[model samples]
Target: MTGAAIGGGLVVAWWFLPREYPNPLTPARGEHVLGAWLKIAEDGVVSVAVPQLEMGQGITTLIPQIVAEELGADWRQIAVEPAAAAPAYPNTPLAKRWISLWDPATAGLSGGVDDMLAERFATSNAFTATADGTSLAAYEQPAREAAAAARAMLAMEAADRWNASWEECEVYAGLVRLGDRRASFGELAAGAAGQSPPDPPPLRPELADETPQAGSSEADAGPAASFPRIDLPSKVDGSYRFAGDVRLPGMVFAAIRHGPNNGSELTGFNVERAQGIGGIVGAVKTKRWLAVAATTWWSAERALRAMEPQFKTQYPVSSEDIGARLDTLLTAGDSFKTHETGFGEEAMARVDMARRYEVDPFHAAPVETASAAARLSDGRLELWIATQAPEQTRAAAAKAVGLGIEDVALYPMAAGGSFDARLENDHAIEVAHIAKELGRPVHLTWSRREEMIRSRPYAPVYTLVGAQLAGEGEAEGGGAIDALKIRAATPPSTHEFGRRLFGNLTPWAAIRETTGMKDELAMEGMVPPYALPSVTVRHVPVETGYPSGRVRGNAYVAGTFAIESFVDEVAAQSGREPLSYRMSMLGSDVRLAACLQRAASLAEWDGGLDQSGQGLACLRIGDKETGGRIACVATARQGEGGLRVSRLTAAVDIGRIINLDIARQQIEGGLLFGLGIALGSPLAVRGGLPASFEYADLNLPKLGDCPEIVVDFLPRTDGTAAAGFDPGELGVGVVSPAIANALFSATGLRLRRLPLLSGGL
Candidate 1:
């Protein structure tokens, strides 16, 4: 059958299959389920089922807060449970967004969250993969409706007892009241479960939101968070469990070593040396990796080191080779136009200014390395792991152990910090194999060296930007850019990642399948947020012989870095101030323009003249209507040790803020992450392996290295903006270019490459 026919057949089959899925959150005795998303207990405690993984993003709290606000439940009584992989909870938004990746041939069959094909596919496959900041967009409305229905049911139950109309009852703070009569949600739980809901759920008119006080001082130190994070208490008390904390009866620890890169195979290992190590249980060897199990992780790691496994690489990757490939592709390779606007490339025959920028592959470098625990018994496989794509992980593990998908059970756990790193499930698959080989429960953890060797980093990019400006005598400096063109040379990173993620192909096979394809997702954000009359973006695919996957900010990081740096250079070439030059082209995007103006005001605008050591940059994440906007001003100077950033001031507009505290925390964290990428996180490939495995060697910013950060959110008027746009990635993309521009302002030299000092003085 053709690809489209197969996809259509699968969707139809899924539709006909039974949709009933047992509730993952089973109610305790005396508790009642009013909706699929939540349950109410006799103690008046509300347990909300969160479908997304909690990777320190405060999602556990955000979702419950929405329920509490709509259901009129007390925040103090709220509890959270991780939802099991089931058909009832499908991330339709994410499914629709990634339709092109998962079902390219039938992509046209899916439109939005309401698309039947996307919904059926997501539901049947239990596709709850969490990436791309789609949690709120995917779950908010359904959660609200569920909560509203539950509230109505509770009121109906209480009203019947009081001989009053349900519509006349008041429900708030976990209580239903009718004049002199009052009853807690716990008192009506059993009765509420049997009560019929209103035909149309009575949703609240307003969404959960918080407003920051005006002025720099007030905004800087906003009111205390109304709803504190739910996970903080357990996390602080060391009671929360991560994948590394999973311990089972007779569970042996396993440490693994994988070949450096794709197209590599394990050749040999010294079994005698490994057996001599104390506490060593046994060793498992595969075609591409070797693992040693022991009583403890340290012992297992030590045994693996003693074994001294060897691997042979057909084509070893090196930084120099990757760079040469990018350079060559950028200069003479055939380019595919990913996006175009206005006159497109026709107006790029002559340009008033041009510049080139380069960015090397950067690792995600999450705090926690890949870890998983697996057990194989009675023709079944059980896995405990923190994965963004739980179903995919389970399927991969089942396939690895030569079992059907129905024979696998996956227990989800919280991740330390993924930044999209947990999307890869190689560790889960390896642990399954190790457990099957040993016939015992095995907890496998990839050593930092193995993670650095096996994990795919973000793609390397080489960009050439050209612009046409008005005549010099027209306005102050050379006036506004009349036309712009950008040509970026990079591997089809997103396509390759999708091949591995959706197709479950090996890294080498993925690369071969998508070597020359144009990846529009990889070229996302290349279209400048500014209002240029004519703009064209071209993607020049380069086969870098190294696998690349999604990092935190994805393409936005590289795109913003190149665009903002080039814009700063253009501002200097013209006599216009950097801030004003950007603001001039932002007439169509008032939200971003407002952010730029506010950020400048907060940072004490200085026009970026006379080596002032202040640089400015702004970006829009989604689009003009519903996207998030951010503007940053970075202050930096050359320090004795190296480059030092003293402070960063940013003004952001993420629409109606859900939790102010979490939003600010996300932006602040994203800024620091971007800073790490700007100054560290360079992957230097040598013989197909990362040159350094230690985190300390990456030169990531320490507590002392972190600059004084000031974040101010643009206050929204009633319904002026869309519901909360994700603030997680907005800060990441803008910080790099802001720091680069600041460095140029500090020194006379413009650094066109990431890791600012990489190009040397």
Candidate 2:
């Protein structure tokens, strides 16, 4: 049988099975349960359940806005509840997208968004991971459906009391009214709970959207955000609670130190020295790590420093060794084809132009380090932490303490910032072991140095791009491409990450499992968006001793840096304007072309003339019809201090806008993040650890260093009900190339590597 047929059979069998799931959101005494997603309070407050983490992404408000917009509730009365992990809230879209990671054997069986197999697997496992910008895609419809159902029920109750037909009643602004008679949702909350909703709930005709008025000033833009962020007040007043804020009656602080490299064994530590420290509780030693617990975190950290733990590794990872491996692989190693179109390799027999680009590994460097609080009592473990994959964290904690999965209670907490760093559960496992050993509550936190040593960085990549001209006798300056080929030498980072995340294997074990596997995700965004006759993208997986995993922007950051930099070089060689050269190739990508045009206009295009100090780049995230598009223009100069970026102008088309304020915030933040990558240190590794641990050493752009950024969203002309794409990572991938191109214009020199000055000008 075909894979789809097997998936269909499983779906049929699953429907007949008894699947009873407890509601994660329990209503308070005065609140009535509307649906799994929300509850209506007697005081007219609507509490919406949000399954995704609020790591400064405004999801806490975004999800609630979707619910309130659909239910016609007042924005001021809407509240947010961090939902617990349950089968009721599964990120189906993410599950489908990551089918190959979780179940490699049956990955090909169901990878579609609507596949029942993906839904069943996600629901059964309660896989509510928050990554890849899939929150809006996965939870929007479910939230809307639940809100719609509650709206109908409320209207029915109010209609019965008024002796009018429920179909004739209108619900708006928290009120259910029939002509003049009306009742607040709060007043009908008890009766609505007993009322049966329509078989198919009455849904609003349009999705939530807003269009920014043309020529609007910064002051005018403030009013466009109809529903302000719910967490803003508490965040400003220092009342917002994160995982690190968790406290228990008998809780003690713990500090841990892990081996520098994976597979390293902890030799020993100065137990006598650690015990002599004041306020020291005790120390727990494991094969791979040592943890010191004390009355306060400072004492615990001090104890660890005094103990001086020693580790032994078979081979320590170093930047020299990694660079040597990439250099050798890029020239002669075997390659596996990951993506192809049209003629594939048949048309790439002869290359007209070729360029090589190298990108060093990048650290996520989230403000918050790994932290988790664990308490074990009577074979039950309660964990408080911010994790992208809550179920995985819970399972890891349970296994560490030798307890059943059900014997764990996980309290979801907001993260300070993850950037995919929180996906790893080592801290969760460590806290569980410490709590179990100590027989008391233990809050474990890794120091900055320890975080840099233990956390995985983005894989370094070496890429060689070749292009063929359109005609046989065409000059190099023709600026027309016939074929393109890309060969990237890097570890199978995503595949390795999948093994660690889904298979629950150690980093070294995961690397062993996916040694020579082909990873398309590692080569994502390699194919050019322009019209090309033939293209071939290849991945050469090279092991570098050290493990690398997911970071914000994933492979796109590296891919775009290579492709866009090469494109800009091509434009310079062809004696054509950068913007026009790109525009000519965009045959059917009208959205991206529009973005480029608008961005240029916004920045007052100067045609990228010599010493103009302006550069342009554009990118598309998904597909042509339903994807996020972005174009960025950067203004930079070679100042006395160094490369100084004065301004950045961006035009984005994420289909229909959901919340204009949040969208702009994401784009602006992503741009600055990309700027950091463009100019910050390469985070070179030495002796199996990062060379620098302090944030100050990274040379990141501070408030005074930040450039002026202007972001504008294209109004949706297709319709009002268009699907909105996630704008979180779009700006991140496009800014580096734009900045690179800008520097080239200013200096008349081409820097063909990430961190443009890594090798020195």
Candidate 3:
């Protein structure tokens, strides 16, 4: 396949197009392969290859829907396939996202720092097709270009046969038509083969330069306002295969017994009598590993439970230990200062109001347990696992078996759910190691308790806010925020993640020093959009033995919670209406102000706290990496159960909406997820291990706990200022603060910590 299509725009596998076919879906004679993303068969059926994982996010459906719309193909005839591992199919959205984290002016430098980071992220093969709300934005440009190229190729083929210029032919509904004479894509498939795909007639603008909401003007697939999803049919018909569905011949079920906490090693075990059970296969034991293989999973479970393996450490440190360390760190001085706008240390001397808030550690608890099935035979290793980072799994698995990545075929399956848990593929590597050592195919699934014990929870965060308000008649009326200083302390999650990304070769500290972003994990999404004369944000890095990783919104959620909550405290202390105080400070940030206004109008804010316990909060968040802007409002009340979110409304602007139905669904999902975290999901630690390992132990919100949520997309009909768009939802970052603000309005007490834990409301 050729690298460049017509007009010099990149098509499929544009970065590193392969000389030979690289995917599993091979085209037959008379069929054409459009680069690496699309293929048209002799029967007019179109296949779209997606590199992202299908974790119930509707990405697989949305991506192909985009292609079908641009290609003029019937949605019914389109099929989606998982793409193979290749350097060409990189996570472009993530690359852009990392670059977005940097603000040239805020970083105290200008030049090409953002460009250098973007280049570094794009070339580095660190991410896989996992669900991170990046799929829609990442694949939008590539999918549109590939489909447009395919359309052009079909038009050219029709023109050649009709003896007319390509301009005279129009492609519609998978048919090339000129006046009344028409040719089906299947009929012109043979002629289109070996010809370079041409770009669409209307040259598309570069994603970076395009105006925001440009997609609102573009036509989507189907005449009906709501587009149908592709996965529902297969899911309803029971044809969709998850990791549990794979039943290979001669495969033995294995159960693992590892340290309860992550990074713990196995010490000893006793399995003599347990292995004698019926349908028992052998046992695989290593210094740091312990597993029992049997004919059935039940048998393996019985053997494992009976064995009762021991680890080097059991509940090494308790919850009190982690809490003490965090409290000490929060009280300590700052180690790294991220951004300083005006007054710096001078603002602290004139502080009019100050508040301290904390977010306790919580879990990104997905329903699915970590699982992997591996077969080692003939010096080749094959793994079928529910992993978000399949490329990382392939590399880690190959290294475990002492084989090259080429020798390992990693098949990423339909995951039940994943926020960031699947990003850590230690289980897949463990399964491969066991399979290789036993010289047999093994299917290892961690029990529910094991998954919880090994879960990488979000680190606890503490923030201290000191602000000086403006006097009456000064700058946009009275009570305007003049200067703000925020100091946040949290265990560094990104540094550890960076270490995993670069391995032992390059230290994470080196990357942090070179980038000058010492603790992005603690400070992102903490910056307020209010027009303040002076703003200083200090990130105090803390060291902890507890395992922490990115979960959904990551630092953004924690940072927003602290920043917004502190703002509410300041407004209350200043005796100004909370909403009005925010609006007064939002000078010229129309998008954010508009969202707050819309939400307030929807909720009918009357400048008084709801006696029935109503709270209102407005937020404006923009992500440069995903190209998204979200303004959300949340209303809460103290119901019979206490702290019930009665309603939530959001005004979203994320470029163009690919599928309105899916977009709304994602927003709703994001709201529920944020609510769960805001309400509670504390993973108590004791003896250096998670004390709460069962689903019942986690105080996750139920359907009854969640109130009605209303979402409205901001109309982008003009398409003037094109900000990049990511299809992911935005409520996670703002929910906690919104809810906390609501609680304060309902009651006189202000909640400084998250999960509202118990009677705090």
Whole-model Cα lDDT of every candidate shown, in order: 0.87, 0.87, 0.69
- Residues 18-48 of candidate 1: C-alpha lDDT, one tens digit per residue: 6677666678898899888899998899999
Model 2 per-residue lDDT tens digits across residues 1-761: 22344667976665546587887878899999988999999999999999898999899999999999899898988998899788999998898878878777777763353366678878999999999989998998899999999999998898889888888988888899888797998999999988988878888996777655545433133233388899999999999999899999999999988887568889988878766678887789999999989999999999999889999985688999999999999979999999898787898778879999988888888989989899999889999999999998899889999999999999999998988999898899999999999999999988988888888988999999999875332254386777899999999999899888887898989888888888888887787788778889999999998989988888888889888998898888777789988998888888899889999999998999989999998888887788889999999999888889999999998876678888899999899988888998888877787888787887778999999999988876665465488898998889889999999899998887888788877
User: Which stretches in model 3 have alpha-carbon errors above 4 Å?
Assistant: 1-25, 28-31, 96-132, 199-226, 342-348, 472-478, 504-517, 608-612, 623-627, 721-724, 727-729, 758-761
Candidate 2 backbone collisions, by pair? none
Q: What lDDT does candidate 3 reach at residue 108?
A: 23
Looking at model 1, the pairs that clash are none
Model 3, span 1-761: residue lDDT tens: 46346555554335344333344446767567876678888889888888887777787787787787777777777888777555546675565444423332333243365444443445455344454476755676677787778787888888888899876877767788999998988888777765676544343342222222323323222233344788888889889888877788889988877674544567777768585688878788765558888889889989988888887763376666766776787767445777776666576557777888877777778888888899999989999987776776788888878999889998878787787778777788789998987788888888887777766778778788888777764344555667888888776666555454434212223234333236653576677767677888887776555666668778778777877888777777667777777877777666666667766766677664645355555544553322455555666766687566788777665555667677677777877888888887566777666776688677777777777887766555444533335545476777778777777777666887877644364
RMSD of 1: 2.9
lDDT of 3 at 645: 78
Deviation (Å) of 414 in candidate 1: 0.6
Candidate order, TM-score descending: 2, 1, 3
